[model samples]
Target chain A: MRMDRLRELREAKGLSREGLARVAGVSAKTIEAHEYGRTSDVSVSIAYRIAAALELPLDDLFSASLKAVTLKEAV
Target chain B: MRMDRLRELREAKGLSREGLARVAGVSAKTIEAHEYGRTSDVSVSIAYRIAAALELPLDDLFSASLKAVTLKEAV
Candidate 1:
């Protein structure tokens, strides 16, 4: 349910809450809810799409390890 | 939305569908729905809980690679 790393990563990428939501095909409120820990009910597809939008592996969303686990490497 | 890897991994662990659901803290129907692609709206916490039940990294749920990413290493 915690997503501090996601907020930091999104900020590091210079993406706005709205920007990430748009590209990830989620509502801006969805981004806000996850980032602020307002909800723990995120969908798997949305989480995966956000990771894909950030060009990082899905683990990147939940982990702080800088090691890049690309989708290719993951699959 | 595809989670064939989850079904394969579950079976490889020699766990019954109901067993995994109980261990993963999900409904048996949730396991069936996901394994059979009958639904695409899996919750993030449920997904993570299932991965924890399997003792596998979250990425393993969505990917075919056999590399084991442990929770310690993931953190």
Candidate 2:
């Protein structure tokens, strides 16, 4: 879901994960994790940086409909 | 800072911390932490839920300029 969209966005911008990471001032691993949806949650700050690098609004990269399991739900 | 904005938004909407949590389906502690900037990172998923409950865009609650300490910086 997120992984596919992130990959599409990155590719659309002609950026590799490493390239996006550089522009976003984050580690390539972080970009990779986001692309793969490896992390359980994405920090708001990270999303902001990636959106800035991609030159898009944060909501575009992550849609409002994306559901997440809250800690209340987990417990 | 992120905390101030979130706190202001919630208050302006006539929502207490616990009330916002109930609306957002997250723990009250989670809302409190975010209001206080206690957490180092905010999950994008959580942000989406809160934004929905607040009836605002995610970026409004958390500005794009709210910088975070990236993992690379932490290491």
Candidate 3:
């Protein structure tokens, strides 16, 4: 969310939000939430799952700002 | 779990099992289960939390074999 580029990343992989969510084991609502910036901070687990779905590193799935916040906070 | 290197990682991070568990928002039972190899596959969220607790990338907390299995499986 907030420039996380989730939508772009999913599109680049040629996956619909629902398709990605299926692979990531999360609800499409969650994917939509991230894509729309309704959920700005993503948990590392969720990020990791999404990254795995895309065959990317976890960092590549998140925006720098979200990364900073998530990393600074305790898991 | 099974060569996940979780114990080595916690030690390297200067964290006791309980300390790491605390930071990761998981129970020490889970950490002990992992360290003793009673558990072999880590869910991405748990892996992400442990990695975050140590300020490392998700891959750093996992062994190659475990990574292969986890990544290959559905999230």
Candidate 4:
């Protein structure tokens, strides 16, 4: 759920937080919080908006660091 | 951003929506909406919770259908 990539993608697209929020139909604060990792407990719908706005695959938004330990071992 | 797998995983773990929500620190309605695909724009934090509660990798929750077209060509 890391959003570093999302923010980077948004910036690369030349979109401001407010601009992206409008396109996603969410509040600026919501987008800001998401970018800062404040609202980790977000709905799937918001995730879609982010992916759409960033022009990324929904999977990309959820993609974890390959360097991290796998879930199979974590559990 | 499909949540079918989330629901399936929750069920496999024998957790009710309420139970999962409680564990994830969100309302049951949130879980319900997420499970039903009502919220496609969720935050990364919530995504992390869902993954942790389901004992899955964050990517597992976001993994898309490989059969679908990729985002690289979408834009």
Q: Is candidate 1 or candidate 3 better by DockQ?
A: 3
Q: TM-score for chain A of every candidate model?
A: 0.76, 0.77, 0.78, 0.73
Steric clash pairs (candidate 1): none
lDDT of 2 by residue, A3-54 (tens): 3367788999999998998888788998888777787666666777787788
For every prediction, compared with the true complex, DockQ reads 0.22, 0.39, 0.27, 0.23
- TM-scores for all predictions: 0.73, 0.79, 0.59, 0.50
Best by DockQ: 2
Q: Which lDDT value does model 3 have at A40?
A: 46
Q: Considering just chain B, what TM-score does every model have?
A: 0.77, 0.78, 0.78, 0.78
- Regions of model 1 farther than 4 Å from truth: A63-75, B63-75
Error of 4 at A11 (Å): 14
The DockQ assigned to candidate 2 is 0.39
Error of 2 at B32 (Å): 1.6
For model 3, residues A1-75, the per-residue Cα lDDT tens digits are 232778989999999999998998878998898787786455444566687888887657656665456545544
Count backbone overlaps in model 4.
Answer: 18
Model 3: chain B TM-score vs. truth? Answer: 0.78
Which digits, one per residue and each the tens of the lDDT, describe model 1 over residues B1-75? 545488899999999998998787778888888788887556666777777778887767875332222111222
> What are the per-residue Cα lDDT tens digits for candidate 3 across B21-60?
8888778988999788787555444555677788887667
Rate residue A65 of model 2 by lDDT.
39
Off by over 4 Å in 2: A1-4, A64-75, B1-3, B63-75
True contacts kept of 2: 0.41
